[model samples]
Target chain A: MGSLQRLGRWTLGVLERLGRGHLFLLRTLLAMGTLVRRPGLLLREIYSVGVLSLLIVAVSGLFVGMVLGYQGYITLVDFGAAEALGTVVALSLVRELGPVVTALLFAGRAGSALTAEIGLMKTTEQLSSMEMMAVDPYKRVIAPRFLAGVISMPLLAAIFSAVGVAGGYFIGVGVLGVDSGAYWSQMQASVDFHEDIMNGVIKSMVFGVVAAWIAVFEGYDATPTSEGVSRATTRTVVHTALAILALDFILTGLMFGDI
Target chain B: MTTRRIEITVGIFVALGLAALFMLAVQVSNLGEYRGGDGYEVHAYFNNIGGLKVRAPVTMAGVRVGRVTAITYDAERYQARVSFTISARYDQLPTDTQASIYTAGLLGEQYIALEPGGEDEVLRDGDVILFTQSALVLEELIGRVLVNLTGN
Candidate 1:
């Protein structure tokens, strides 16, 4: 019985610490200075986060569009609103699907890599060595990562939305035999500059920032061991995914309500 | 460095992507450059314009000659006020144009179609379109059709 209570206490402490860890990261960011001194690092990190991962995002986006189109077309046909298939695809993809799916893909691809890399660096005392050498690790590491994420996330989302919308068209018109001219026209009419693309672009940049920050924070704090790195990597993906989804919901509410 | 190559590649991708988007955008326009400025404007008032989105095309004799331009519902008047842009080239409608809510098909979107009344007077941009049709929802239409067919 004593052992059970002790075990429960220990579990509670660990959970409490885990909950508090994000606040520690937030504090670290608030204390972070010298972001301006690290232009080169920022540019490089942006490439890694934004550019290297395009192929994966694009492929996923294309398939999502096709599937969304397939679903919307059949559903609209049942109600005789078959002409509305294009608008439905465009509205849903740009407003909701694009930012989310792309962020999830980023979590799988980049978030895990960031966590593992940071965890390994922590274990090796390499970050300490950099600190001892008077190198500002935040400037060299975190700033660039944050900047890169901000840059790349929107581009990735745009690619996702466009591919998805086009996929809808190909599947909806070519495969489903809807008139291509009418399909395109409805899509054009349904979307406006404010409601669709602009909102998506803004949401994506926010997701990028949150996802990268969580991944890096988890990794930077991990202990110096293989197990630590593995755990950090898994946590990075999970946390990033959750943050992206949560942020998506909040931003969608704010953006649409204003518009 | 390898990073430079990545940036250049990404730049190209972004440029190409934007170009593709621009091309698609151009293709999606009304391109109805065929401005037949001979049609008269029509107005409608509805107690409720539920699901009656703007830009829904107005059809006559199974042909689309104009599109809905705007929708404004006056709460005080207890009416949904809508305006449609007709080509000026079509025959001028009399002041007593009868407009009604229409469906594209069984499950189609709701539109406001105008049936010309022989009032010997034509409808202009601000004319109060007489005898308007409100939208016919699919479920309601279906229920009616089914009930009639059942011979009940």
Candidate 2:
């Protein structure tokens, strides 16, 4: 009886939090009206969230591409289809890995940072003080950060995919002795603009909105305490990762199911 | 001072991201392909299209001249009708051109190959290639071989 009661309580708690999170998101989005007037605020958050996260995303992209090149060469060579190394690498990166991996990394880097920052503000009573000063903290504080995240995500994913493609090119053509002409020509022939590349860009944009939403919501909803701040930060990372993966599955099905 | 630095860094970051997208579109994908919008449509009817798909390259003498645009079934003629577009530059192709579906590599994608014939008449928009060969299905080939062996 007690176990069943605990399960019911947990379900209700989750439902309540989910409802509250959606309300917070709606409010934050509504508060974005002031964004155009204060572009500097949005730019500053973009600098922190997007610019700061570029290094990890690029370096990881390069390594991932190189590894794919090496592994793809090993397997494709067995089939005597080593000429398709570029197509394999580019397709995989743009279609699946680019947005998905970049979002995972962004969750760890920017998502956690946003949560911790907002949680800290709440913990230190800064948000409360802002409330006292007749300033809507959601407009002044949270909206720009959330907007920065949404804006940065697709750009970051694009950078990752481009760098990854370069890395794959270097490893496949330079190190693995694949023909440079075949490498590029095959990729161009097979990778369609609307089907593969644009689909990836659309995917990254969706992921961006989602990652930013979860980050800000978690931070805004955090309990005003030191431990609560830490816990919220952890939750931001975990939730963002799971959300990205789940959304990736759904997006891939909808986008590429015909292929 | 820090604000200026932040603005500059953000500017550079935005530029880099845009540049990356440009590269993906131009270099990685087929967005840079010459889409002159000066192409003429041609149709061909085949016994079997096999794995032929829309947007498959239409090659002439080993050079890509166009792409397959539409694939449909001809209920009246009991054939697979394929519609493709050839760039205006290749407008001199003879009306007697033969269209055949061929696979690249062993297990690669299928494409339509055009073999030019000696004719004064040029293929215009909406003209159908009368000579068409279907894609070679491996299963049918094996079945034929088995029948011949058993009969022998």
Q: Each prediction's Cα lDDT score?
A: 0.75, 0.94
Off by over 4 Å in 2: B149-152
Worst 10 residues of 1 chain A by lDDT: A31-40
Candidate 1 stretches with Cα past 4 Å from truth are A1-38, A69-83, A246-259, B13-44, B47-51, B54-76, B83-100, B113-152
Error of 1 at A146 (Å): 1.8
List TM-score per model, in order: 0.73, 0.97
Interface RMSD of every candidate? 3.5, 0.5
Q: lDDT per residue, candidate 2, B12-114, as tens digits?
A: 9999999999999889888777567658999999999999999899999899999899999999999999999898888998989999999998898999999
lDDT by residue (A1-259, candidate 1, tens digit) is 9999999999998887677666655654654455565355656666677667888988898899999889998898887778788889888887889889988999898878878877888898888998999976666666567556666777788778888888988999889998887788777766655456667767887887788778777888776899989988888888888888888888888888763
Query: After TM-score superposition, what is the CA distance of residue B50 in candidate 1 from its true location, in Å?
Result: 5.4
